[model samples]
Target: MWLKLNKTFFGTGTHIYLCAVYIPPLNSTHTADDLLNLEAEIANYSKYGDIALIGDFNARTGEQADYIENENNSIQFLQDMLPQDYDLDSPIKRNNLDILNQQGNNLLNMCLSSRLRILNGRYLGDSLGYHTYFSKNGCSTVDYAILSKDLLPSVEYFCTSDLNFLSDHVQISFKLKCDIKQYINKKDFNNNNMKKFTTYRWTDVSHGKMYEALNSDEVKNKILNFEITHFVRNEKGINEASKSLTEILDNVASKTCIIKVPIKQKKSKIKKNPWSDNELKDLKSKINNLGKKTKT
Candidate 1:
């Protein structure tokens, strides 16, 4: 079995965890059964915050360029695994992108994130593609570098340069802040009493950039129009249900707020003597001053 270690290696909080996974090598041809297993694994693993599936998938980018047999089937494997909370980032179109047609090279290198926000429920792309490593035909490209949608806005730059002499494919690297603290804070905000008091304020402040991305008109429409289906089972009669925009939003909001409680110290029995007269007077004065400042 490929190893699946759970911990926040990049972000600060446990809410954002890095799920390091390694898939056992399979034949280079990429089989349907292999794809099915891959899909199941991804679905099982996606329960964690904004999953990022790194490492080789042994599939070619050509699979994404045009319809090949079983292409949607392959993508469906991944799509099914995505969290119900959000949509994965989609392919971004760039100017001067016709170069792919000129070079007969299709952008197969992909990075998917599910932390995307929806205006209407649709996801948007942030210009995802790959760079050529070399001019030669025998280039090797690492399979995938999926990201969480919420984390994509912070991406300063992403590139894969061609290494003509060292190897066929160029080495890929990206620079993004790995603020584990933020993730930890987010994780703790739901449970920490002190943090909860300030959580909404901090979240509003922090989400300025993230909200901008999700609130784009294009992004909102995509989310609103995305397809969904329902399956039902009944003993004697069957009732199928479908979710509307309002229903989906309400559901998502509820799930997002469900936080795990963190271990805490038992309340201390040690009690201070009733506040001294001077201390009480001083506290009263401070409170009055705070009230005055608020009025101002």
Candidate 2:
């Protein structure tokens, strides 16, 4: 099982967590404690984000007529384990049968307690009852697309299709009305386009020329002539003044200094290895000496 949080621009910083899971079959060697542990792990993950746990849980949902052996403990455990935010409502409104089994009853009770409406039940009414899984035994709705209550409004459509040619389970599809925004880092904006000042490495020859330019009569008169009051009045005026100053400095630097292209250094890769007990002891000794050296 794994959880992936996807950020979208529904409002701002809206995240939808997709939890993919596969619970072991009830008849398998997995014990009740194992199932409880799995549920605990899922519950922990749910606290971090809005989650949609989807997978073949192997627990029967009483949405079909097929009389397969029910895993009562697993069914009840999962229903009890899910957080309040999860929607337990069946997406399909009508099943092949009118009555629900033990698993269905437990699921229904869970939904009622959580106040979660089923997406499939809401979209597909009694007339469009569909089965998700098929085999020699019979057709049943085993697979499900569960979502959080917050995501209920964003669900545009939800229905099952007959796309499973090789597999026993059919494909369940749903569309979400959401706008995804691409994440941009602030550091990416610090490129050459944003740079206004020309950078130069200071040397003895360049430093002497820069000193002469700053103290020159022409440069001093230009600085004196610049109107500080005109620039301080508004935002646009300040930008214009800054641009003019940058131009002046760039001209002076070109005349007084030699422009050198910056050298790009290749980063060295450091490989890490697990340290043995002796190595750890040696490292501790080094750290103790460093503290003594600092004191001295």
Candidate 3:
């Protein structure tokens, strides 16, 4: 069973499909059926632009070869090969278990055929190949994050959490590189508490640069044909025109202005809070260190 969530970037036309899956575990009857169904699902979703399959697959594919390399001069399976990493656990040995079952072989074949890469032990967060599932019986990695090899540019990081207070399966997470500005806070009419955004330090930017940008051909052309480009009489047209101009200015400012984030000036002296004495800070640090285990 699985659920799919798709997001399409407006201007770029990039479609990202995320599938959360839970394949039934291997048993006397359902192993073969599950493998076939999984392969079909992959085939169907691979047609989309960029896709990721994530969840507990129940297949213990430990360090198995996900690709079929050059076997002989006679039969050639897939020319596009999976990237090799010597630093990861050896192909002959795995961090969790050396045993490979029938379910594992089925998963390996499916990945090889579908050109999907498992982002478990090789990627950033869980690069140590730590086990993702723990129980009274034993510990192994059953949860995985799989992605189409073509999405290598979009996949930023992959990791698994060690803490599992709720269930036997630990949490797994992966980040996709996208425009952060899209998710930034906007004005909310429902809530009284407003969101704060990083402000621009206009003084930090050069006046000459700002003048040159506004007087550039792109801005001049838009300003000249502003009326012809937009209908300003109606409320909708007025809002549209305002938004277009705002986007243009924001784009230009993004290139020229510095954001007002925390930074140290070389000439300025550091200011210390009045209440932050060395002794108090030491106590606070000890308290924080003690609290981390309980909170995290």
Q: Which candidate wins on lDDT?
A: 3
What is the model-wide C-alpha lDDT for candidate 1? 0.42
Assess candidate 2 and give its TM-score to the true structure: 0.44
Residue 5 lDDT in model 1?
A: 32
Badly placed stretches (over 4 Å) of model 2 are 8-13, 32-35, 63-99, 103-117, 124-129, 181-296
lDDT of 3: 0.67
Can you write out model 1's per-residue Cα lDDT over 1-296, one digit (the tens) per residue?
23333346455232443334333334435344544454455455557544444444433332232212344456666776767774334443332121332112221222212232111001122133443333445432333444555555555555544454434545544455556564465654454565333111224333454455456675466456644343344522222233444454443333334333444568979654685577787898999999999999
The TM-score of predicted model 3 comes to: 0.51
Task: Encode model 2's per-residue lDDT on 1-296: one tens digit a residue.
Answer: 45455564343234666656465665678566443554455466557655565655444555542222244444567876778675333333434322354544444444444333345444643224466667898766655566666667777877777744437877666777755335544565566434543467666787678778887887776676664436754668767787878767776787587776555556898655565577787898999999999999
Taking the tens digit of each residue's C-alpha lDDT, what string does model 3 give over 1-296? 33444353322235656777777777755545866877787788667655678898887887777655544432334333534431121122223342466777777788777877778776678776678778798887878888776666576788888764447888999887766356445454323332234456666445666778777998777676764694756778768887877778776676568866444336777688987899988999999999997898
Name the 10 consecutive residues with the lowest summed lDDT in model 1.
117-126
Clashes of each: 16, 8, 0
Off by over 4 Å in 1: 1-10, 13-32, 58-143, 180-296
